[model samples]
Target: MEQRLSYLKQHLQQNDIGMAFIQGKANLFYFTGFRCEPHERLVSLMVFPNAEPCLVCPNMEVSLAKEAGWQLDIIGYSDHENPWEKIQQFTSDISFQGTMLGIEGELLSFSRAEQLKNAFPLTEWTKLDNIFMDLRLIKNEKEISVLREAAKLADFGVEVGVHALQSGRTEMEILSMIEFELKRKGISEMSFGTLVLSGEQSANPHGKPSMKTIQKGEFILFDLGVVLEGYCSDITRTVGFGAISDEQQKIYNTVLKAQLDTLEMCKEGTILGELDRKARSIITDAGYGDFFPHRIGHGLGTEVHELPSLNENNSDVLKVGMCFTIEPGIYVPSVGGVRIEDDVLITTDGYECLTAYPKELQMIK
Candidate 1:
């Protein structure tokens, strides 16, 4: 916690902001060890240049915050007190009186952002969106340990999901069974809703499990992950229902080859855009260029989707100690779709994969 605080202090000074008002609960909890409530009360934090941090939280949660390991000064208010007043009090002591304040621009609601500005009429506040995110790009030892555990648990759950696939079964039935098996394997719960799409349904990249039953010669996409120790793991694998045609096998293999190609190039300091291009080019060569959509992958961490996006547009270079997903897919509206994903981690030595689930096409009878 002290190290994290030190890093944030450095970031605050570098950005030339007097103080940063962190709004996103996920990043807030990481820095202050306090997770804010929803609309019931304003969960606020104030960070001044070269100063110890402080949190403005509901009085009811102050004790919980202390218990969970709050290292800096804490300020609390009762429900009866207007939430804005509490925020004002927090900012008044730490925030610079007539200078710009910083908040997370992406996560804060427009109304809430306006309310905050109104509260601090004397101060000039800005959204230091990238300032906060910049610190989390590289993982520390503790973070990597937790993510490794999340990967193991999530990988086990994917295997369970794969075995649950079969013909004459509804997508929802397989979903229920996989959910049950995941918990049975001691994966407390899925990080996100399990993706169990069959046949034409798989054509949707994020298709919802439906009453549609499985059949022969169609693609089955399974994208699932497990949440453990506050970290997340995400992997996607598509399999053939039964006897797939030559065309279907080709599509499946193309996606598989694309993922494999990207995996070899995910190293420290690798250009992120070039990695996405590697996968896009491979699929394009296979004559399924338009069908293969979305970025190659995204960075994975506490919030599941964090920094270092794997896309044609992202300039964030791949760095050692950063963890992200490599999920490349091909979507076909009627025939079906195929996607094979893996969770890869950049290490000091070389990159290593956390998701060890078999990548070959499985044919469930």
Candidate 2:
């Protein structure tokens, strides 16, 4: 903890940044070790260059914040005392005059930012998106351990999903089955909603569960993750119901091979974008390039999507202890889609595969 504090302090000093005000849930947890409330409550975490960080929250959460031993100072706000006034009173006393403050650009809203500007007009606000992104690119020992287990729980969820995927099963029923299995594996909370799509609906990556039932020779897509100890793991696999056509089998094989080939090239010091390109190349060569439209993969940690994205534009280098997912897909619109995802950890030598569920085409005939 002390080392982390010193590291952050030195980073702030080197950058000549005055303070980092965090409003997002994951950001607050990473900087202050407090993650109870969502970002909606107007709570902020202020990290100064050489002093103990502080947390601003509602009056009811003051005790809970104290229990976490995160913030050195806890400022409280109440409904009786105007929330905005309390915020101004608290920040006005701080050493914020003429200081260049950093804020989470994407997570902090325009309304809340306006409030901060009105509170301290002299203090300039800089976006901290790149700064935080760099900090969270590499994972720590504690983080990797939890994510490994989360991957196992996700694999367990996949087992349930495959079993529930029978002919004539509704999308809602399949979701319930996966949730029950996740709970059975000790994953009480989900990192995100379990996605269940059958037949033509499977082509949509973010499609919600519907009343559609499984159709013979059609594709079924399942994307799910389990949260264990605030960490997350995500995996996606497309299976066939009943007898599958040879074309579907060929497509599934192509995606699975692409994923494995990409993982083979992922090592410490590898370029993130290159890894994404490598995956894309294999799928493109197989003639399913147009079907695979999204980025090859993304970073995985405290939140499912963190930093150092694995895409064409990201130039971040892969490092040891960093965990991310490789999900390559081929969506044929109304015909169906095939995507097989796996959470992998960059190791000192090569890469470690965390999701051990089966990737071969499974027919639930």
Candidate 3:
């Protein structure tokens, strides 16, 4: 937390911003080590180049914030009290008036912006999104450790889904089994809604789980992840319930090849756009060009999706410590879809795949 705070202060000095008001929950947790959901209330971290930082939150959360390892000065207010007025008081004490102010422009609502403008009419406000995004882009050692554990749990999720498969089971029943097993193992929540799409429903890339029952000679897609220690993991796998057509086998092989080839291309100095195109070419050559849709993958970390997107147009280059997913899929309406995804970590020499559930097309009896 101290290292993160020092970085933020250095950035503020370099940018010549007098003060930064951080309100995003993720950003707050990143800098202060305190995470909270401040819904319908004003919670902020006030930082200055030379002065000490301060945390403002609901009066009821002052103790909770301290327990979370935030040692800075804390200001609390009740629901009836005007938070903007309290903000003005804090700013006045630090002489933060008529100078450059930095804020999360992307997160601040229009009403909140107006409130800030009305509070400090003479202050100049600048957007701090880029500054903070860059700060959290690379994962530190501690963060990487948490993410590794999260990936293990995500692999466990797929394992459970595959074992729960049966011809008479509905998509929802399988989904319930996955969640129930995770909960039994002490998992409180999933990184995202668990996805268990079967047969024709698998054709929709982001389809919701339905009551449709599994059948012989059909495909089932399992896409899920778990949140462990504030980090997240996501993975997808498609397996056949029983005997499948030769065309289905061909499609599955094509997607698997695309995913495997893309993972091989994931190394330091690799351009994200070219990596995406390499995978796309494999699926295209297999005569499923139109069926393969969506970007190659996306950044993964604290949020299921983050920075350094993996797509055909992204010019970002892969760097060590950067984590993202490599998911390649071929969706055909009225038939079925096949997708194989894996979480990958960019390493100094090469790359390491975090999610290790078998990608081989499995047939469940």
Per-residue lDDT of model 2, residues 1-365, tens digit only: 45665677787788888777877877767776666754356678777786777778888888877776664878788756666676566666765567888888888778888887887688877887787777777888888888888998888888888887766789989899889867766777888889988878888878888888878888889899987877789999888888877778888899989988898988998888988898888889988888888998888887898765789778878888888899998888767888899999999989998999988888887
Give the Cα-based TM-score of candidate 3 against the true structure: 0.96
Q: Which candidate do you rate higher for TM-score, 1 or 3?
A: 3
Give per-model TM-scores: 0.92, 0.94, 0.96
lDDT of 1 by residue, 132-243 (tens): 6777778888888888888877777667767877667888898888778777767765778888898889999988899998888878888888877567888888888779
Please list the C-alpha lDDT of all candidates, in the order they appear: 0.80, 0.82, 0.89
What C-alpha lDDT does candidate 2 achieve relative to the native structure?
0.82
lDDT tens readout by residue for model 3, 52-91: 9999999998998999899989989999999889889988
Q: Compare candidates 1 and 2 on lDDT and give the better one.
A: 2
- Pairs with backbone N, CA or C atoms under 3 Å apart (clashes), candidate 1: 100-124, 101-124, 101-125, 101-126
User: Model 3 has how many clashing residue pairs?
Assistant: 0
